[model samples]
Target: MSDAAIHPTAIVGQHARIGKGVKIGPYCIVGDKVILHDNVELVSHVVIDGNTEVGAGSRIFPFASVGLQPQDLKYHGENSRLVIGERCTIREGATLNPGTEGGGMLTKIGNDCLIMASAHVAHDAIIGNNVIMANYVGIAGHCQVGDNVIFGGNCVVHQFTRVGAHAFIGAHSMVDGDVIPYGMAVGNRAVLTGLNLVGLKRRKFDREEIHKLRAAYRMIFASEGTLRERVEDAAELFKGNALVQDVVAFIAAASDRPILLPRNGPTLD
Candidate 1:
């Protein structure tokens, strides 16, 4: 409290834990149940309420509402939690909600995330580290967004969907299913277009690994066998390839939503 700087117009609850070097700018409101780690910054006109915790060094820009009650009709003041991770930047006008009882009572955003302006993270969404959500992206409730995922502007992900690690959701995509690891999804219905080869290359994945993944992808999506059969065959063929195995395991995982396939592939009912 001694080292923290709070503007005169800011209304921070007395019980709110303010760590050293924290900066609460003018017109900010922080509720009693909030816990701000060291060096956190609220850049004016921000409201953080509920049983929420913001990690160290995270900066929340103007008009961003965090740790608010969930929009779920079933949410009945259950003391659900919202946890934002370290060094993340939550841009202006973003809205983040806490979880409900039906969805583990926790909404968590991992470290180094860039939640762009006007993005919305609905209740119970578990977002992984280094993720990027472009402006106007909306993620519905209970969605699982894996590490290094990138959501382009105006993208909308349906509730309960799972987006795998390093996946890319193109602009204006309406994703309603499970997107596999390193996969690229685009368009209105959001079919799996291909691997996120550009991302892989930028991240320094070697040519041999990319080649193996491409081959496995082709085999798994071929119009020959059932999806389950194709996955099994790919698993056997790319047994030693870790990257391919990641895709295979993501597809094999139990999910309420269907695994997204290529536009030409057989659709899952």
Candidate 2:
């Protein structure tokens, strides 16, 4: 609450708003239009740019770049914003860019997410709550990563792709299309191997729900039936389960780039 509590070595711009009980370490740069909510902590050498807002209880480590300008060529310097929700942890050397002119004007990270060191969240990306981005993971522009999703180290998510809730992406994989909820995807160009049974079990999914998801995966990825036929079959079989229905719909609606097929199975083509 006291101005003396702020490290004199840190440079807080005249227009910057520092909240009560905030702790800013030495040599940190807090720019104008930056708002640090209650009890936030900025470690040494952190750079929080203008138009950036850090919510309550978030901790930004040293050398991390929070709310910088968009990397897009079309940005044109439009005063876009970057908003980090409450209680998130941004590790050292992480770079989170703001939104571009084309993809709205805000890049957002939800509450309680853990963004590991050296991770890059590009312009206009939306990361949901409880998502884990392991070290060196790169999320490209306009990507929408759902809640509770886990990305192993060095995973690269393509632009405009949607990774559904509870999906698990293995290390060193490349995600180009939409990853369905509760699915396990791996490999260089990630493929859906099967239901994320381990994750589902850890999340305490009931047996019936797991069974339904397995059945849906079989119908969509393993069946000999045409895409339409497989979708119809899955629709009938998984009528009551919304998660299964979402998988079915995602597979059916996928165009240009379909979800990855299982590696060990017979080819669907």
Query: Total clashing residue pairs per candidate?
Result: 0, 0
* Model 2 residue 32 distance off true place after TM-score fit, in angstroms: 0.7
Instruction: List model 2 lDDT by residue over 156-192, tens digit each.
Output: 9999888888999999999887888887788888887
The RMSD of every model to the true structure, in order and in angstroms, is: 2.5, 2.7
Total backbone clashes of candidate 1, pairs 3 or more residues apart or in separate chains = 0
lDDT of 1: 0.94
Task: Give the lowest summed-lDDT range of ten residues in model 2.
Answer: 260-269
lDDT of 2 at 28: 94
Root mean square deviation (Cα) for candidate 2: 2.7
